[model samples]
Target: MPGFSPLELEALALSLRVALWSVLFSLPVGLFIAWLLARHEFFGKGALNAVVHLPLVLPPVVVGYLLLVLLGREGPLGQALYRLFGVSLPFTWQGAALAAAVMAFPLMVRAMRLSLENVDRRLEAAARTLGARPFDVFVTVTLPLTAPGILVGALLGFARSLGEFGATITFAANIPGETRTLPLALFSMTQTPGGETQALRLAALSVLLSLAALAVSEYTARRLRARIDG
Candidate 1:
């Protein structure tokens, strides 16, 4: 803490904030979409799946640009929200979180879909025969069984959000203590003269944070597996 500058601390805090919000907002939607992909066949299913995973294949900058086009003040959704609800997202922390969420969503969905696919359909059918509603079966059976995957997905999304750079910087414009997360902060430091020390500190912090997230995810996954097996 002694060597870590206030700016670095702010950036780290903002990154966590953005990542937390991104994961929280995206989790339910991720689970629902994953379930749909794993359990149902519908028109445009392939297209929907492709779109959900598009961010992984597309450049981050392109994703950011698309977000800007769809969410900028003059953009359709942005304009409607502003006119009806007086809300704006561009260049704000919320926009940063949205960008991070878009980038992290595919990983979250993939993890959950795999877990859902592995769930025993017979159990669900038994629940249905026992008079459980679809929602009840999902809540009481499917969710509990797939909890590990959901946890892993959330952690993975959080980690990805923490390190998001191109999309966040593009959509949120790197405002200090607002939209400037750890990666953007490091980028800014590198551009400054004689800022290598602070940059190095931030770089190390990023690595530590990522490692911690991964460690927690692995530990949780193992515990969940053991519990399920037992």
Candidate 2:
């Protein structure tokens, strides 16, 4: 904290804020999509799967650009929301969180999907055989089994969101104390003549934070495996 300047602190705070919101917003939707991919068969299911995983295949900049096209002030949804609620996202922190969420979604969905795939179908069947509704079966049996994976997915999403740059910058222009998250701040440092020192500091922080997230994820995954095994 002592070595971190005000700008670095601001960027770190913004990154955490954006990552948290992105993960929180993405969690339920990601779980539903993951469940669909892991369990159900339906028309266009393959297409839906592809679309859900598209962000992983596409360039972050392209994703960000598409978001800008669809959510910018002049865009249809953007215009409607602006007129109806007086809310705007472009070039704002919310926009940054949106960009982060979009970029991180594929990772979250994949993790949860894998978890759901590993769920014991027999357990769900037992729940249903006992006259439990499909919804109740899922809530009581599937979700509890999948909770660990959901947590890992959320952590993965948070880490991805924290590092998100191209999409965020493309959709929400970097402004210090606002859209300038850690990655953006580091990138900005590179462009500035005397900001190398600051860049190094931010880079170190980024590495540490990423490592911490990964450590927690790995530990949690181990616990999940142990529980299943026991």
Candidate 3:
């Protein structure tokens, strides 16, 4: 507690906010992509799957830089966004969230896709036979069956976002009260004399948070499976 300053707490809070928002923003997209990969056959399907997983293979810094180039103020998409909505991403916490989201997207998609694949197509057919529309079948059957996977993906994404360093720093910079997440704060502390204590504290906090997320994810998945079996 001695090492936990108000500033440090703020950084922790911001990191949590970014992680939460990133997972929220990416979850729906991940679900859609997962459903497509699990159930559909189309031209370029392989390519799209590869593209969805690209972030997992690419360098985090490279992903961050690409985001900057595409979503920065003068970049084409950035410019269009600014012209239309006056919203910007670079140098802000939201930008850091976006970077985290993009980097964690592959993991989210993979987990969801696996979950979707586990869903029984026969169950979906039964729903259709029972007069359920396509949308109704998906909403009531496919989604519930895949809930465990979605929860796992979201938790994984949150953990990944918390530890994100290169991508977040590159896109948002390590400014206090803005974009300085736990990792960034820890790194910053290492550079200053007598900052080791605070760094250690932040590191411990990061570990605890990650472990908590994993535990929750596992518990949730097991409970879901039990209910389904029941």
Off by over 4 Å in 3: 1-3
Q: By TM-score, how accurate is candidate 3?
A: 0.96
- Candidate 2 structure quality by residue, lDDT tens digits, 1-230: 36777787899889999999999999999999998889899999999988988998899999999988888899988999899999889899999999999999999999999989998899899999899999999898888788788988999899999999989999998988889999999999999999998889999999998998889888987887677653
Encode model 3's per-residue lDDT on 180-208: one tens digit a residue: 99999999999989998888898988888
RMSD after Cα superposition, model 2: 1.5
Q: What is the C-alpha RMSD of each candidate to the true structure, in Å?
A: 1.2, 1.5, 1.3
lDDT, residue 8, model 3 = 74
Instruction: Tell how far residue 171 is off in model 3, in angstroms.
Output: 0.7
* Candidate 2 segments whose C-alpha is farther than 4 A from its true place: none
Residue pairs with colliding backbones in model 2 are none
lDDT of 1 by residue, 123-226 (tens): 99999999999999999999989999999999989999998999998888889989989999899989999989888889999999999999988999899888
Predictions in order: lDDT: 0.93, 0.91, 0.91
Candidate numbers sorted by lDDT from highest down:
1, 2, 3
How much RMSD separates candidate 3 from the native structure? Answer: 1.3
Worst 10 residues of 1 by lDDT: 1-10
